[model samples]
Target chain A: MDIQAYISSGILEAYLAGELNEQEMLEVDRVATEYNEVRIELDALRESLLKYAQVESKAPRQEVLDGALKSIQEIEKEKFFEVLDDEPEVRIQRVNIVPVWTIAATILLFLSLGFNYVFYSQFKNTKDQLAALQSDQTSLANRVSETNEQLQYAELRIAHFMSEDNIHIRMDGLDLAPESFANVFWNKKSNAVFISVDNLPEPPHGHQYQLWAIKPGVAPIDAGIFDHNQLVQELKIVRGNVEAFAVTLEKEGGSPIATVDKTFVKGFLKKS
Target chain B: MTPTIESKISHLLAERNKEAIELVFTHYGSLLLNIINRVLRDDEMSEDVLQSVLLKIWQNGHNFDSSKGSLFTWLVRVSKNAAIDKTRTKDYRLSQESKNGVEVVSIAESISTGDEIEKLYAKQLIAQLPGDQKVLINMSFFEGYSHKEICENLGIPLGTVKTRIRTAIKHLRSII
Candidate 1:
């Protein structure tokens, strides 16, 4: 083959462009490998292209190098994990290092140690789990007892409210709060008053709900003050001949007088 | 001196030495970036590809047989192939077409000459080439266009494309 004509055929350039079919590329590879002259010519052509590529060279931003190094290190770490995945195979290949009986003895020893460790771990885990279950049971029992006490108290309140000896009065919301409502349960014999505040806006900070027993042409007697957390509360028992019950917002601790304009709800007593 | 440095890099890379990263990046980073940028036509994407190219070279360093070609040749081949693969992806093609709709044509046209190319790669080596030869070299060598594709793209005969690329290579070798 005429080396000069072959070099001039542009096949080497086509090979470098990676445009040749696989067979043609193999042929070019074979020629370049067999002939020193073709190899030298191919290297020179590659050098020229490299120089051409150098013409457009622009330095990448400075930080890209750091980013690249970080990525490489991370990939290296992942590769290390992948190598670990193949560790058992590598260990198997090293079986010839020791005598067969010695190796078997070592394997048996390891198996015994492994079983001991697993049993100990499971025993300790079961102990811890049992302790946790006992603690949970104790807490749950306490909660159940607390709930039972609350249920008993609720039943007593229902019986008291349903008794014929109590006068039940429904209170309507005042002009200040049209949506507020409460029920007054007044026991006739004991003269005790229990008010169930069902729906009332939260009182202003540093304020409390005050109850009063009202009668005609006299100062409104303070019943009792209660926080909003409880729906039903007992108030100071009225003495006798109470006309109506009213609730007002007053500062913490009881006030001597009701803030009439701040009354949230009021109810009138009717003849039974 | 350059050959000695190249051999040092080749050895370090084969050994998987971290020091090879600095040496390779300092020596050929720009050239590789330029090759990728030529194919990608986006500076940001090109830079990203440049990093992966170095990583590829590092990971496959043992495969680089110096008997076949110089280290520079291998780097160029790897970088060019990576960039070409990126361009062939559906995401890249769709984004290129959707970005400006006409940017695809402009990118192809600007392979030979453009304002950005004028400012960035205005080395006197390629600047001094005759217009036709420069265009052929830009498309064939830098853009990785084969002779047949060059023919179809330029609307010239395939024989003409091959002859011009061969002539351009010869002229470039003589100049260097």
Candidate 2:
């Protein structure tokens, strides 16, 4: 490289003026390092420019520099004091566990209270339900007693007719109506019989059950008429020796005598 | 100042020495103010720029490379740049233009060198350039303006302005 030619190319002036782009500046920096003449030229250029700028230079006030220095010093002092302030307090309070333990206890107490509140509320609800169920049971028992009293009143009404001497015939269901059962309590003196169809279910609609008093030598007699609602009925009893009792379906009201094919229940009583 | 004094200044800046800082205030404070006053020509703003420059030097002295330039050059660059930046702001320029006629003679005289008579004479030789070249050198050196700004301000092409300033410096270098 022609070092003198490089120095005379006006590049040093550009470098001194800070006019060179970064690439050019780097190149100039390299050349200045490699060649002593280039370095001297660059320095001379910078010094000359510095001298020119110094001639036109405007100096600042003393108060400004003083104020800036003072502020920086104050900032440094504040930082030092802050570090000092933090150190002792941190050391003294480092081992204190009271606040941590207090927080833990507070959390535990809250959880315990919450559990107790939930359990107490549930217990209260269960107690209230139990009291309500007890009341319901008492009312149901009272209803059952009332129904029993009504049943006794019906038995008393039937006993009035039954006190007289009458044929007391029991009816056992036959194979055709195996589940059907009835009893005939007859008073021979009053000629009245109370039919308790206790074990018989209600007959189907448009059908009536007829009762008969049967003697082996005679034809069956129409004792009385009964419907489904008449689970127990007071019927006018026939004044005769009844060898056996039988029930059959006739028309809706009943027939003069029982139809033998339609017998749903039958029984016989022994003479006492 | 010797290398020892320079290193001591660097060390004091590193340690953030208050007394050293006060000494800076007592010595170079007025010099910085005078430089800022010429560029900005406003006492208050000059003071502000000087403060900014001193604070910068205090904070960044560890990064200063003496091989690149003298500490004085760095200080001058910082103060000049601060003052120029202040002048570029709308408020400073508007106020400065309005208060343009007020001659800041005392600040200029104080900044005029008596300690380095030969160096001051060398600087004066460069100042004898034509008004346009003089302005270009000031803008480039004192205010840190680019070649582009000098061209725009002086109504010359960028290449021509660069060449002219280079020629001006070459002439100044020969005479000095």
DockQ of each: 0.20, 0.20
lDDT of 2 at B160: 83
User: Candidate 2 residues A1-272, lDDT tens each?
Assistant: 98877776677766655555545666776676677677667666655654444454433334565688787888788999999899878866764566778889999999999999999999999999998998898898888888889878777755754565545667878777788788888776676777888666567777788888888799998888876466668876677677887888777887886689988888878857
Model 2 is docked with a DockQ of 0.20
lDDT of 2 at A201: 59
Candidate 1 docking class: incorrect
**Poorest 10 consecutive residues of model 1 chain B by lDDT?**
B112-121
TM-score of chain A of each: 0.51, 0.41
Q: Model 2 in CAPRI terms: which quality?
A: incorrect
* Fraction of native A-B contacts kept, per candidate: 0.49, 0.46
lDDT of 1 by residue, A1-272 (tens): 99889988888877666555545666776787688788778767766776666565534666678887888899889999899979867777666545687889999999999999999999999999999998899999889988988888788778889889889988889998889889889998888889898888888889998989998899899999987678898888888888999989999997999989899899999965
Regions of candidate 1 where Cα sits further than 4 Å from its true position:
A21-23, A58-67, A74-272, B1-10, B18-47, B63-90, B93-100, B108-122, B125-127
For each candidate, give the interface RMSD after superposing the true interface residues on Cα.
Answer: 4.6, 6.6
